[model samples]
Target: MIKYALKCEVDHGFEAWFSSSDGFDEQAAKGLVECPMCGSAKVTKAIMAPMVRTSKEEAAPIEMRQAVAEALHKIRKHVEDTHTYVGGAFASEARDMHQGLTPERPIYGEATTEEVKALVEEGVPVAPLPVMADKPAPAVQKKLN
Candidate 1:
């Protein structure tokens, strides 16, 4: 079976499964396929990106992994030391900044999958900061240099 991303003339995008690529072509040609949203038979395959696994997914050497982990830890530590923690309200806070409802500043917090997806879809600039679940962020020095 194969899954295809399809879009209608009205730009309603959807996905459908078929036994083979030829099956989709045949059904579409026969006007058997219709858009689920607008019920439009004038549908075509949408520009879709296929999932691909690369050779780099293989586990690296222990030293390499450790180095990468350390780098991630440093980045998280910098954010913790320099940025504000908004806890679970990250998505709303980010949106506010994007819409100019709130002053923009560096912030770190937890966000739900749906919230993050919505933020990205709406074109709000946000990125995930790596954190070590089993470890703690580095301590900020209190004594001035």
Candidate 2:
């Protein structure tokens, strides 16, 4: 398998794995390759410096992955705590902000794949939030009198 750093037309960076270089080309040509964040199919391979591995131990350690995960969690928490939840109107709100119809503000919400693609096409900056698994609600206890 080969790993590639990919970017969407909107400049969202991501990574994917393919069976081969040819496989990547084929998938991209067929519109099978898409950005994980915004679901934009206008994805392309990003410039990558070739890594020449000297030893198996040169791979990233578990600690590094943990650190990355912790950082992402913190970012999610910060956005949730600070940004306005615009719900399903994320696309329109972002567009309004971009067009100066609304005040620019930190906002987060749900948006469809088409909405994101359109926003990107119109030069509106928008991105998808990483969805974490929902925590179960607290259980209700019954009181016997």
- Residue by residue across 44-110, what tens digits does model 2's lDDT show? 9999987577866465664665555555555677799999998999999999999999899999997
Winner by TM-score: 2
* True-structure lDDT of candidate 2: 0.76
Task: TM-score each candidate.
Answer: 0.51, 0.59
Candidate 2 Cα outliers beyond 4 Å, as residue runs? 1-13, 16-37, 41-58, 134-145
Output the TM-score of candidate 2.
Answer: 0.59
The best candidate by lDDT is 2
Q: Can you write out model 1's per-residue Cα lDDT over 19-106, one digit (the tens) per residue? A: 8989999998997787654345788999899856598675345556456657767787788999999999999999999999999999
lDDT for each of the candidates? 0.75, 0.76
